[model samples]
Target: MKRVALVGMPNTGKSTLFNRLTGGTARVANWPGLTVELASSRILLGANMVQVFDLPGIYDLTGGAEDEQVAQRFLSEAKLDAVLLILNACQLERQLALALQLKALGAPLLIALNMVDEAKRAGITVDVAALSEALNAPVQLISAKYGQGMAECKALLTGIFSNESHQIDFSNIPSASTLHQTEKQLFQRSVHQPPILNQSATDKLDRFVLHPWLGFPLFVLMMLALFQLTYTLGTPLQDYLEAGLTWFKDGLLVPATANLPQFWQGLIVSGLFDGVTTVLTFAPIIFLFFCLMAVIEDSGYFARAAFMMDGLMSRLGLDGRGFVMLMMGFGCNVPAIMGTRVIRDHKARLLTMLTIPFSLCSARLQIFLFLSGALFSPTQAPWVVLSLYLASILIAMLTALLFKSKFKSSEPFALELPPYRLPLLSHIWRRGWGEARDFLRLATTMIVLGVVLVWLLTNYPTQQHSYAELISNLLAPVLSPIGIESTLSIALIFGFVAKEVVLGALSVITGHEGQALATQLAHTLDPVSAYSFMLFSLIYIPCVSAIAAIKKESKSNLYTAFSMAWSLGLAWMVSFIFYQSARLFGF
Candidate 1:
């Protein structure tokens, strides 16, 4: 088997080309740094088995940026058969510098001019033969997104590896001045621009979308609509899944366990089955949320959002790149924290990692949607969810503001906005399906353990004054101030494992699931207290997975401990204020 790595500048369609060659999703996001880690897959090229690696995008091989360093170390150290250097045809001049550096290394190089379709549309053309002859390397003009010229590209790959003779010479690396002059020469020889270059549709759209007066407001409106649409459309599909899961449990599993002892029956049916299924019920909503996000990202508007937020982000000690990482947190904070590698400044990266856990991730979103819909009316539920999202942004912003002085970043920020294109259906499906699978995996593992633990604590040593009640009694004094009672406190305690477990914990504790559990919760707490609990849940500590990610990324136990402590303290203070203030208003 031969190993080949895909290398390119940011947003040059490397992941798309990797997917085309290997039939893998490879996380095709339009925003930079979304592919923070190496993505690899194996496929057969003719009779030869080939391994393709999609590396993080880097601007310069010698650059100090985290992604750049990652790509640099891999290229300099890894044993490889060929290097597939992908360049955006429309931005050939700016990208040629990296190619020149690679060529200087004497690595086995194959230059691929990606996005030729978009280039042609923009009245740009690349002279492929001229470029190949100038570099003395195999160059293929291909559109990875549309599968144009993919056959020829694969044939070219076979030819490169057929020789089985390649060497990398690190000693011959080119200086910046030499690389720049050579890049200019290469561009002049092989690339041509129209005499009168016209502004693209992306520019016209940016006039409104990126407007100084309208950009921020448009972002807010888009967010509001995103949640509303997710809830309105996803709720029905979730209900259907919930019904199917319920039927599977009640109609099949229940009868199957009929002959079991009472204790075993309760554990299997009420504790494990109900717990996992309750979490599974919200998979549709979470999947739809990821799909909507995928559409925004793949269409290139997410990068524009980062660009628009650059001013406000700088005020909070970050820049546009930090903003992108924060938005990535909405899908999952673990990866978002890992994605902070894109922020070159150490302080800014740490600050962004600390702020990301506050994001309203899909796990927490499931809990919010369930509780809000149970307590609030249908029309009011979406507002409740949207308000939580706004609160998330507020808390993250406030976190950055408070820590800005300690972790100040002087690194300048600049982001390139990719041209907007209609999102590919296959990419959207891959992202959504991947998220849904992750949620189910979480459900079957952590959520199941949490539910069983809750059941044991609530049921063991007698139902009345059980172990759970004893634990909650100890916590009642501290929680009472924030309208959190004993049973709810127990759920919060178990939620430290995973937010998805909170509902499962509720189901086990109250001996109910689905609507029954929601009804039970509705009766247990008033509207203000319910909202207060939601606030606490939203702002409290991140899941255990996220904590591990923070520790590994920051490589500082002290920093990780501080992140945990700060979020815990902030959650209490914020929830207390809301609960007490709402009561004062006579609500």
Candidate 2:
């Protein structure tokens, strides 16, 4: 099969085009020997199947940014038939430099001017024939969003395979001046923009969203609403899922396993089913959260939020990019740590990676929401969750500040804020469904295993004094000071493997699931100890995946060891203080 790559600068509608062309049948594949993952899919174009890879968005081919380096390396390594260079038509003049760079590398390039509809709205015009002649390549005007000019674009891609291709040589990057001049000449000859462009909706919204004083506060409100909305909407669905799972267990699983020995039945029902299903109920909440987050990100407000927070971030020894990675950490710390590669400075990258684990990932969010809802009023539950988010940011900032002097970053930060547009339904569904699938996958696999282990430990050697009690009693002295009880200590021990298993392990050990488990937990602890447990979970060791990511990205066992030690020590101190302080205040 012929191979082609879709390459473009950030927010050039490149991924949109890739999805449109490949019908969203893409899978993420790690490029050989590279930490970055690219989306690749096989699509039938003109009776021939071709592998189309969507490369990470980059500003320049030879830039020092991690994404740029990945793009450069992939192009150099992959034997490709052609490169589909997608450029934003509205930003044609500025983007022409990349086109010229690719051209100079002797790459077989088929240029697609995407977002032409948006360009036309801005009163910008591009002469396709003139641009093609100037660049000596096939240039097609396309609006990948609405499927405009797709046929012509696909035809151009198909035609490219007819011509023989040469290896992309990146060693001969043109001088900046020459590339700039050629880009200018090409833009002048083929593109036209209105003398006075009207102010866009994005600009109008930014007046308030990006206001100096109101921006951060507004961001806080947005976050508050986001969490509140997630709970308000997702709680019902979670309840329904829990009910359905309970029905399945009582109605089907119990009957199916009735004939089995008592031990086997207990292992399958009480251990496996109870533990796994408890965690699985959070799948709806996780999906809903990611969907809302996708809306914020796709609307272009996330970039503006990063811009608004850059000053404070700089003081904390990070830039807006680090802030973005920290927000990404809310989804999962592993990828967020991997995302630190975008930071060019080694110290800053390491710092960002170290700080990301503090962000409250969805896995921990499950524990917080379950506990807060079980312990607090509905009106207060959202606030309790929001407070944890605040704690996450505060902790991350403090970590950065503590390590700033040791690992300083002077690399200048620059970011692009794309125009605010309504997010596509397809995109939203993909984000939500993908996250839900991942959540379920984790629950059924690792969480199930962890729960079974918890069940075994709790059920073995005699019902009067199980192995779990023995182990928890052994660690009781250390955990007791921090307000964590023996049973919770068992969950924390398995939590080191994966935070998703915490609730499952608790359910298995407590002999309850879902709301019943929450009720049981209410009997075992009060608000003070509950909050203390949440804090400890928030600040303590990350899951095995995140630890592996830190080790791989930082490439230092000592640094990885330090990260674990720092988080463990900090988690204990913070939790102990909060728990003790609350008790003193008569909470």
Candidate 3:
């Protein structure tokens, strides 16, 4: 059996190539650090089988950043026989440097010229014969998206077993010969052309987008366009999914249970399916959103966006690299936290992870859409979304400032405006399915338990009164300061597990326990109160999964408790100020 490792920079499509080679695609994007863990699989060549490992894609071999350093040690120390130095043929010069360093480790190397189709489409040619002659080993042209050179890529590695014939033995690693001229030529021969751009197309874009003169306005335009696209294209469908999920639960599930015993029916219809599926009913919107983001990423526009944010990112004591993680936070924070392994600075990484939950995720956007759609005018709904996103950035930056970490951003990073290739339908499906499946699995587990527990709390009556009423009455005074009534507090309690539950719980209680709380709030409060309530809802408490993630990542229950407490406090303070300030301004 043969062993192979895929190596490249972040966003260099190593995972994409891994999928093509091993028939295993774990979600890919233009975003960096998606593959933080090393994934393994088996590949077959004729009758022979090969074990393959897909380690995290890193920009350099230098031991820095958590994941990159971890990967570096893996390559240098692990008992590996061969490695395929995957290169973004379109951006070879930058990728070639890493290839050089990998070759320095004395492994039997096959240079896989990945994204060849992309490079050719971009009017660039990689003279592979010249490349192989210069590199001292086999070089193959491949397009993972199209599976063009995969067979030859596999064929090139068949001679690795015999030391006398191959002259590439494991004992050569770390020997003085490791840095000899033959190794240097192997590194140099692996590439034909330099990076695609001289000035770096990203620098040109960054000069404008990160410009002190125009950056903010351009940033606003980009964000506004993204939000508008999501809501404009997404709102009708978001509403549709909600309606369909409701119809399934209410029109079908509810009435079917009308014949069953009252308790049994509530447990089945409302508690199990309604509670869980209703929260997950927005899967289509989440799926569509992941698709939109996937297209942006695959088309290579996202890297430019990250480059543009470097100036502001640097202000927050992080490099342009950290911007990618923050952008992923808009999708979800868990992956964003995991992605921080790309950052070499531990303090900066922790701060970036801590601040991501503050970013407005798509889950919370549904709440914004519902409120602004119901309460505010249609055109203004977008402003609410826009403001929340802007507020998140503002909050993230302000909080990052409090930590006051000092860092220099002088890395020799180059950008490539490679030709935009058509996103493969299979690639899109593979990426989207991985996330959607994980989400469904999660919905069935944690959120199902949450809804069932809420049902019990509402159904089980205490000696004095109903437990639901007791819960509502108890939280009434606490939420009263922000003008949120007992019903909303009850909704927030369910939301302690996940934000998606707040609306679902509200929909369920519209007729019963929520009635008194709703009436009292409506009579006493105004729109300002609603705004404060929405703001509070957005920032309060890390969800059950988020807390669990914090504990896992930070390795401290105390840290998780502290994070929950501070965010909860911040939510209250922010909501309190906004409500009182709105009143003082005579709104």
Candidate 4:
């Protein structure tokens, strides 16, 4: 298949165009540097299937940033039949400089004047024919978001394969500053625009949302509301799903397998069904969390939050984009770790990856929500959950500070805030389903394995001197200081597979579900120990998937081992302090 690469400056809607062309959810955020890795998908154009690669956004091909290097390497390494140089019409003069740079790369180029609708709305008009003549390239006006001019763009791309590739002389290519000045002259010659004093709705809203004093407070409030909605609206749905799963197990699976061997029946019903059902019950919360995050992300508020938080992040030798990736961590650590690619700095990216494990991901949050409702008062539940989230943020910040002196800082941080638009329901659904689907895919395999292992440990050997007991006894001396006993320690062990499995593991051990399980937990754990356990869970080594992501991103076993050792040590120390301090106070 022929290859076509989508190349453009950051925040020019290039990813959105890629999604439209390839029908893949490559994570379209209204912020710069979201596409840190190369994303490729094949699409049938006319009679031929062509592979379209979405390269990481870069300001200059000649620059030395990580993303720029990736793009340059991809162009040099990959077989490319054509390059689609997308540009933001609203920022034509600035975007054109990158386009000019790409033109000098001597590849067959097509200019996609994206965001033409936004430019028009801003009272700017571009003379496409004149601009095309000047650039000596085919300029296609497109709005990737609304699906306008896509067919024409694809048709043009299809025709490119038949034509000879365009080649330009690199020797005559102008310098960056010279190209910028030339782009300005070209823009002035071919485009007419209104005066710069006019304020759009985005500017008006940013007056408050971006205000130094008000922005951070509003960001906190928005995040609080997100959690509040996740609980309030998701609880009933979660209950319904849990009940449905239980009914399926008792109503269908039990009777269907009644004649099977007793051991087989126990493995099928008590082990697999219960464990899988328990994790699935939390799907509602995960879905809800993603939906809310998608809304915040699509509405462009996430970028503003990053901009607002840049000062605090810079103090820790990070930047606003790292903080944005941290916020993404609250939904899931896997993607958040992947999202760290947006951080152009190698040290900052690694630091951000290290901090994400402390972000109270949805799986950990699910466990906390379950425990909070089961053990604490109604009014206290919200506060308990909120406190854990706050603790996660505090620990992540502290972790950054602790390591700030060790790593040198990278490039200066700059973020472009896209205009806020109402999030489409389809976009929200796509993002929500995407995350939920990924969670299920990971959870199904890991949870089942974890459950089967725990079940084998507890059920085999006639339940006397069970493996859980043996392991707990072995670790008791070490765990006792943190107020964690055998049962809890065993659950924590399985939690390494996935955090959601911890609750299910406990339920399996006690032969209880729902309220019965809650009652059993209450008898086993005091408030202080419970809180200490929560704290430990919040800071412990990440799940297997997260560890793999860290290793893949950092490409260092030592760093990955360090992450585990540090988190485990931190968890133990923090939990021990909490437990011992509370006991000393006679709580």
Candidate 5:
């Protein structure tokens, strides 16, 4: 198959165009270097099925960042048929420098002037015909976000592949200075633009969102609002889903299974149905979080948040990009670990990965929500959740600081600030569904397996001296000091498989669900112990999938083991302190 590589400077809509061309959602965030790895998809062009590779965004081929290196290696090592060079039309002069350099490599090239709509709206005009003539390559004005001019771009690719004209002479690539000069001259002659009469909306919004004094507070408020909205809006939907699942299990599943063996009935009702239902009930909160995150990300606020946080991050020998990845960790630590690829410095990437496990992922948050609502008053529930989030942030920062001296930071903080726009409903839905899909795909199996294991352990051998009881008895002494009961400790073991299973495991063990389960929990654990348990869940070793992601990204078993050990030690110490301190305070 013909392999075409999509190359561009960071945040030039290359990933968006790749999605449009290949019909794939490759995580189209508004920031640069998000495409840290090569993403390839097979697409039908005319009668030929071609493979399109989306390489990491690069500022220049000569740069030495990890992303830059990945792109460099792919270009030099791969047998590519053509190079599709994408450029942000609004930043044409600066973006064209890389385009010119790619052209001088002599590959059959096509230039995609992406975000042309935004460019024209900003009063910039490009003479596409003249620019194409000067570059000696095809140029297409495209708005990848709205799918404009894609058909023409596809046709151009088809022509290029059919003609076999993509062969490049790498012997005489131009120097960086020469490419810069050529790009300047080309743009001066072929592009026209007028000065803006007023500041852009992005500027106006950034004045407040990125203000020196207000930025941090606004960021805090935004995060709090996100959690508030997620819980306030999602709870009813969660209740509905839980009610429906209960109806299915009772009104249908239980009746149908009455004729079966007792063990089979228990397995179906108590094991599979209960476990799956518990997970599915939390889907609303996960979906809402993704939707809101997509909105903030699409509106270009995350980059501003990054800009505002760079100073604090720098103090820890990291940068704003790592902080963004930490924020992403709230949804899931696995992707956040993978997202460390955006950090150009090796040390910063490692540090970011190590700390992300402390980010209070959605699974852990779900448990916290359930516990807080079950144990505390309605007014105190949100604050309890917020405290855990704050602790996660503090722990991550502290962990980074402790490890900062081991590795020298390589790249200084730098990021492009995209213009602010109202997030499109379609885009938001796609992003939300994408995240939900990934969560289901990655976690469902582990959750179901863990549930089955818990059920088997608790139900087998008449439940008097089952495996769960044995394990709980063994761990009782170790857990007593931290105010964690044996049963909760057992559930935490299952939680290591996937945090979503913690509540379900507890329910299975206690033979209860909903408010009944909550009542049972309240009877077993006091207020201080409950809060301590939440803290432990917030900082413990990440779920199994996240460990695998860390191993894959870091390619170091030692480092991965270190991460697990570090988180485990920290969780234990924090929980111990909280529990002991609360008791000492006479609470």
Candidate 6:
């Protein structure tokens, strides 16, 4: 069995290469010791059909960082037939470090110079032969994004597979410093002009975005505007999707079920079409959110926001890099999990992952907008969403404080502010497509089934009445203190799986109980209780996929369980405190 491995530095297009090679069956995974996770995939090699491993992205194999340690351990253990090291042509100096270290493991190696398109665009030239001689390995240049030179690189690897006997080199790696000496020399001699310093442009923009006194307030304002825009824009698209689903149900399902027997009818009308359509109807909102985040990321202002918030994070004993993941979490948690690998500290990385769920993700925000509008006044809407975000930040602060007091603080973050680039619509559209695909593939597939299962359990009755009433009553005693001794809270609990289902569950409960149920709930539970309910949702176990990710990333049952338990416990206390205290204050 021929086994090949691929390794590279972060953002060197390692994943892009993996996607190109392995045909995109990649999944996120965690290191053995650290909670930080990475993405990997398998690729099929030429005629021999050899196996290839796409390893985690790390800057070096020095074992100084958790991801690096992981790559190092894998390299040492896996008896790989050949290793492919990807290096970003633009960032040659940094990406080369990991490559040299891998070469020292005495394996047949090849360097795929990625981002050649960007390199040429940036006016950087490379001699592939010189680089090959420097590292004593076959070197080829390719761009995974544009597909330039990728075929030649594949052919070269095919040749390696055919020969099955290439010289292995360790001349570039050194035991003492974790880097080979020649690797150091080549980088030092790689004469590229220093990075462009956009001082004037930065000074102008910082006046608003990074102004010491105005920065935080500006951030709040921007977030408020985003929420307003998202709702205003996303609502129409959501309405269209919902309308389409309604038509499909009425025209397609009703006709299809008219002639079928109950068993076949149920399978088509409820299990298959009903389940898929319910989840797919939310695509518009998800699509909008993805597009927005992609635009923010490409413009380079997202990183600037992290820089602006550094002091706040430092005050709470966390680093700014954690904010990067938080911003990503709002779009989807999958990328957020992958983002944590950027953090170098093991403790900080775990803490950040633990707290990310508490941030009101876009999925949660969709539910909030619906419920907040249903419960609150027009003037109070912004405050409702604003309050939820503020609560998320506060909870994050508390989580950080608890973590730091329990463990040592990580190294402070130092972020380089890259020059802002205009958003390329093609790139933004592609990134958005990737995120939209994730929402549908990873989340919706399970969520629709979950919703259908919940509908059955809640709709069907065992004793005198439907199970929904029985469940509400059983939960009422526990929920009575918070004033939601009814099915809404029952649905909220089920919502812990994924937030989109919250609306469906609420619709089921409220529909079963009728319009009178809303009036009754409104009277029994004041605005405070509704607000508390939303807050409880802000901090709970994420969807099944996120939980699975936690298991994979922690690689330990205890940490995963601890993460789930702590989140649930904290959410309960926070909700209880808000509800009970608001009742006491007579709100």
Measured against the true structure, the TM-scores of the candidates, in listed sequence, are 0.97, 0.96, 0.84, 0.94, 0.95, 0.80
lDDT of candidate 4 over 1-587, digit per residue (tens): 78798999988888889989989988876777777788989988888878899998878767666677788778777767889989888888677787777666667778999988888888888898998888877889999989899988988877777444333344554567878778888889988888773888999999999998999778778877887888899889988887887788789989999999999998888888776777777788888888988899889898888898899989987888888888778877887897776666788888888889999988898789888877888677878888898899889989999998886676798888888877778778888888789778967787788878888888868788787788879998988999887567878998998897897787778777666677888888888888988999999999998999999989999999999999999999999999999999998
Give the C-alpha miss distance for residue 257 in model 3, angstroms.
2.2
Instruction: State which candidate has the highest TM-score.
Output: 1
Question: Could you give the candidate ranking by TM-score, starting with the highest?
Answer: 1, 2, 5, 4, 3, 6
- Each candidate: what lDDT? 0.88, 0.87, 0.68, 0.83, 0.84, 0.67
Off by over 4 Å in 4: 163-175
Q: Give the TM-score of candidate 2.
A: 0.96
Of candidate 4, the 10-residue stretch with the lowest lDDT total is 162-171
What are the runs in model 5 whose C-alpha is more than 4 Å off? Answer: 163-172, 442-444
Give lDDT tens digits, candidate 2, residues 317-352: 998888888887888898789878777899999999
What tens digits encode model 1's per-residue C-alpha lDDT throughout 464-565? Answer: 979998998898888888998867888898888888899998888888888888899899988899998999999899999999999999999999999999
Which tens-of-lDDT digit does each residue in 1-587 have in candidate 5? 78899999888888888888888888777766677888999998888888999999888777777778888888877777788999988898787877787777877788899998898788899999999998889999999999999999999977776445354544576656767778889889988888553578877888999899999889878877887888789889888887887788779999999999988888878877776666667777788888998888887888888888889988887888877888778778887888787776777788889889999887887799889978988777877888888899899999988899986686768888888867778778888888778667645687777778889999767689888888889999988889998877778998898898898788788877766678888898888999999999999888999999999988999999999999999999999999999999998
What is the clash count of model 2?
A: 0
Winner on lDDT (1 vs 2): 1
Candidate 1 weakest ten by summed lDDT: 162-171
Model 5 root mean square deviation, Cα atoms: 2.0
Give per-residue lDDT, candidate 6, residue 513. Answer: 22
**Runs with alpha carbons beyond 4 Å of true place in candidate 1:** 162-167
lDDT of 6 by residue, 1-587 (tens): 67677777655666657767766634221111112344444456555666766666666655466666667677766666677888878777656766666556556777899877767766677777767777778889898756788888887777665345444343455653545466667776653534673345556887888888888888788778766766678667766876777787788777968888864675455544554554565566676666666666655666777888888887776777777777767766755765676677777777788777777787787667765655777567767988898888778778877876654565768665644545545555656566567668844565666656656665565323767677778878766665554667657767767776665565444432212334544665568877877877788778766777777766778888888898888887888888888878988
Checking candidate 6 for backbone clashes, the offending pairs are 172-180
Q: Give lDDT: candidate 6, residue 80.
A: 62
